[model samples]
Target: MRRMPTRAKVEMAAYGASAAALAVVPSMEVLPAHAAAAAISGGSLWWLYRKAKTGDFARTIRSAQRLLGPVTGGVVYAAAAAAPGRPWWEIAVALGWGGVMAAWLPVTRSTWTPPAETGGPGYPPGFTGLVMRLWDDAEVAPGTWLEDIEQTVSPEHPDFTADVVALAGKPVPRLSDVDIAAAFGVPTACVTLADKPGHGPGRLRLTVAPTRRRGGGIEEVWAEVVARPGGAIPGSKIVHVKTFPAQGDLPARGMVLAEVEPGEVARINHEQLCSAFGVKAEELRLVAQSRGREALVTLYESAPLKGARRATRELLTLDAYGRYTIGTAHDGTDAKVHMQSAAGTFHGFLVGVTGSGKTVALALMCAAWALAGLANWVTSARPDAQMTAVGRHVDRQGAGAIFTWWMLKAAIALMDIRGRINGEVGHDFSGHSPYPGLVLVLDEFNSLVGDEALGDEIAQMTDVLAREGRKFGIGIVFAGQSLNLSKLGGEASLRDQVQGGIGVVLRIASASGGIAARQATGGLAGDVDIAEIPDRFNASMSLMDRMHGTVDDVPGETTQGVGHTVTGSEAVMMRTLYVHLPKDGSPDGLGEIFPEGGGINTLTEREIQELTELGLWHDWTMPPPSAGGDSGDAMPAFTGVEAGGGIGTLAPPPVAVKAKKATVKEQVLAVVDREMTAKEIRGLVDAAAGTVRNALSDLVTDGKLRQVDHGVYAPVHAPADV
Candidate 1:
């Protein structure tokens, strides 16, 4: 025979004693009736005490009911045996005893008890059990009473029914998981509850205890009870279960994890995390650590550009986890952008300082994204046409045309030198399909976007992107020297919109603190220091791959390695010259001036002079013509003839001169050209007062001209030069 446990043995002994006391009660009831009745009552009292000790109230009630039936029958029989003389009194006494026995039996069976209705003091079924289990298992110590309770009554227990109604009569507090997690010493990984359903009755709460460490310190343990979907447990089953802190031990920095409802993960991945939060994989660590399991995840999947494998490799090598990548090369000669579906995507803050090679890197990435058909480039700068010659193959017709045309129009629109907006600025791009993946790359982004009015517009635009862009495949890339929460409209909005950021510190007095610094250094202080960055060194080469949860330190030298640098003037000249000249002089004007065909060259003297004379070249003038040779040789000269005069008129004058040398009045007559303005002719002719008056009168009389003003005059006939 096996030995029973101590508690079980005690219960058995109590049961045996209760049974023996009840057995003799009926037999003794007939002798000395009053004494017998007292004895029987005493025995019943003893049995009741024993039953209570055994904690078997249900069994005790059943035994009492069985004993009542026989006792009542015996009472009736006794009344008959003792009723020979005084029959009426005897009958009444016997009837009263029988009724008393009947009443007592029912009372014993029906009295209320705690154990049958509820699960004693420990467990309650339905809502009560669910709430209790949530509380009890919340932060159990390794060997504590609560741990034992957890083992006995859990959500998976045989009698476990998650009806929250048990907590209906109890007072419970309402709190978010995050708050509960904070109150407790545990990492956020353990909270698994959801918000309460609209009509649900119970509150969700979490409890945590610090985990004991080997060094005598303690880490936190966590637990929580959340409103689950569906009805109560045992009846309702959990469709999907997720555990957070995907990576168990948190790094020195921190960690973040998320759980998604069955089919809901995809939406969260695309819109909330990727487009709204702009979270790259690397950035997830910080978010996880800070926000914990309750943090919402919204991110999207992205790919590298097609045909840009080399450029992608180079970019990855430089900034391994950076959000940006170099796409298809313009000329198909250098690194061609290859779109890889595995590249992933993010939305977040971006930082690029001066001399950080950010411009080139950005251009390269934009080109790649555009080429891969993943993003449409919306910028106020033209795609450098020279890119076509750089060994990167490009399609002039496909999406490339959209990029080229839009960029060209933007460049023309922003030009300040022409003093007037050009017609090219109005060129229509509405014909092209509205780009679903539109990414506005604002270079020197702060200049236009930082203004109060423009900032508001940008903020609104960002809001739209954060809220609705994912649906339309629209995104934004903002690059600048500094990014602060205020500059981005607000900290919360910026945090939500920008999931990934790249910081390139090319020597600045100060940098945005916290996350900004981490962005530059890849979360490693030694890897970069924005304030101490060397003149030519860019500390922001580290790629904050928020999508991958990594930081790729791409040295400045490496990312900028294959790119060329041209001064502003040089670039301008190259563009202008190459478009007019050719290498072999077949006379595609764009090719000749730029033999290397980059379209940059110096203008010749003759061309300069011609342009100057036309009023087209204002910034420069023609060089002096060379000495000696015939300067006017290139012009056609005029040849002419003269008419013979006066010889025919001389004969009549000789004789007449001798006869009359008579005195003549000899009045000086001054002819004034009155039609012309006096101011105009004042410096051309001289006259005395009276003499000029007579000449004017004579000229007027002769109908030569007339005065238009007091001193003005008009010509009677057409002038020499009109």
Candidate 2:
């Protein structure tokens, strides 16, 4: 026989395997007669399998069997094969066997298998459900242990202890003291159990009481459980449970007390109070409640009699309390000063190290007083007197005039007080009107008058103010790095004059003397050593009364005279005047007294003409007439004469003609420098191109620079110099 083809051999092998599979399947077992329908149904499945293996329709039939499975699928396959059937029963039997095989096929044998009896990796069945289901499971029984557990546990069960325990292993011990305690979410000492009242089997009563642990009381509850004899298992009943918070427990309270009374109390926590007042914490004493109350009361009630208005203004107006109307200006004109004082008198000394804002405080006080409609009279002997003479003069001329005469006089007098009077004495205006009543802010008072030479004068001034200023409404504010009563000649007298003292001790050389002593014992009567003053303008001022232990708003009365308060506006004006005053011609100096920025040499030709017309200039002359037969034999000659002079004196030369040349040059340069380019120089000069170029080149060559880049020329030198 010829060797069979590989395809034919494969087909024969497949058919033989199918036939063997069919034969083996039916012989295994058969459904009973009652299961005959099932058996027949299973036979149809075998037929379909044969169809799937033998025909092109095999994959579809197998897929249909897979989707429809077993019984229902066998019926469909049997019907399809029997449409032209040779034997329906045989087809039925074959289809039934196929259906049975399909139904029992292990499709997932490679990928998955049934878990072992011990179960899979996750929690055993009913673990969560077992916890929930155990109550229903017959082994544990419902309502059996619930009551017993409820006895030791809470009906409103705490989350941590709601657990199930199997009683099969051993006798169920009554919930442990720890477990019972945990069930109530408290400590073990808080829980206890008692046998049931009737001593029934497995019955108990539990009481959970609060425990005093960690110094805090705990709430507690009580419950009872009685076990009843049952058919399956002993059942439990919750008799009673009660919950209540611990009694006799009070909330914790702060230990601080309202020890100090409201009136005249000195707060011990003065640093805290000062903080509230927005001042340096170290500037005040820390007192206990009683002392703090006393101190606070003293401060609240204290007032300076002489500087009452000033004190009120500072405390009320400038302070955190008073809401006084702040006037924009004196009757709506230019704002002159910041009026802060209600009564208009101020008396205090400002003490701070150099650059510690002492000067600024004085200025602020003066301004406040001036705004209050009181004149501030600052008298400083220091060469830098700008801060002291703010509103003393109006314009530069007025400032110059005052500094030339009046300032000089005041300086000379001050020098005389220090025994340094060098020249002849000038006019004394001690008895003048508008006696500047506001504070006489004297800066660097120690330096103004040498210690030895002017001690007496300083003492005398202090005495005068101490003894008589209140009567005259004159206030004094002495400022310095160091202020000593001895420097003023007498401690008692000096202290008497300065009832209201402010000390801003940036760094104290010795706390025992000077402002330290006065500030320590003055109004505040405290040992406050200001190590440094802050940069804020009035930061140190608020501590004045506290450091001195003085009462707020209580002005100290001095026998001197009525104290004058300085307003903010006047202080600003004085500062402006001081700043504007030329250094050399300042009132405290003996420099040239010419008007500021308008000296003799700076006088314009027109000004000179005006002066000459007014007969003010000493040297002014005119040119002679041109010789044109009108004054035959006339000779140009000089004659020293004055204009508008008496008979025998020749009429003075015309100043206009004498100043004409300088005047014309000045006017030309003025116009050219303003808007002239190099190209436009000739038009403005009204001269030939060569002449204009020469003048322009000359101006540039002389160091009167111009904008070369823009081709615009301006005078590099001072206009007045030009």
TM-score for all predictions?
A: 0.24, 0.28
Model 2 is weakest, by summed lDDT over 10 consecutive residues, at 568-577
lDDT of 2 by residue, 109-221 (tens): 21233333333223334223333333343333223343322111211222111223334443334556775554445677655555545544344444444422231111121
lDDT per residue, candidate 1, 449-518, as tens digits? 4433234434444444443333333345554554433444454544434433322232232444233444
Among all windows of 10 consecutive residues in model 1, the one with the lowest summed lDDT is 569-578
Candidate 2 lDDT (Cα, 0 to 1): 0.35
Model 1 compared with the native: what TM-score?
Answer: 0.24
Q: Pick the candidate with the highest TM-score.
A: 2
RMSD of 1: 35.2
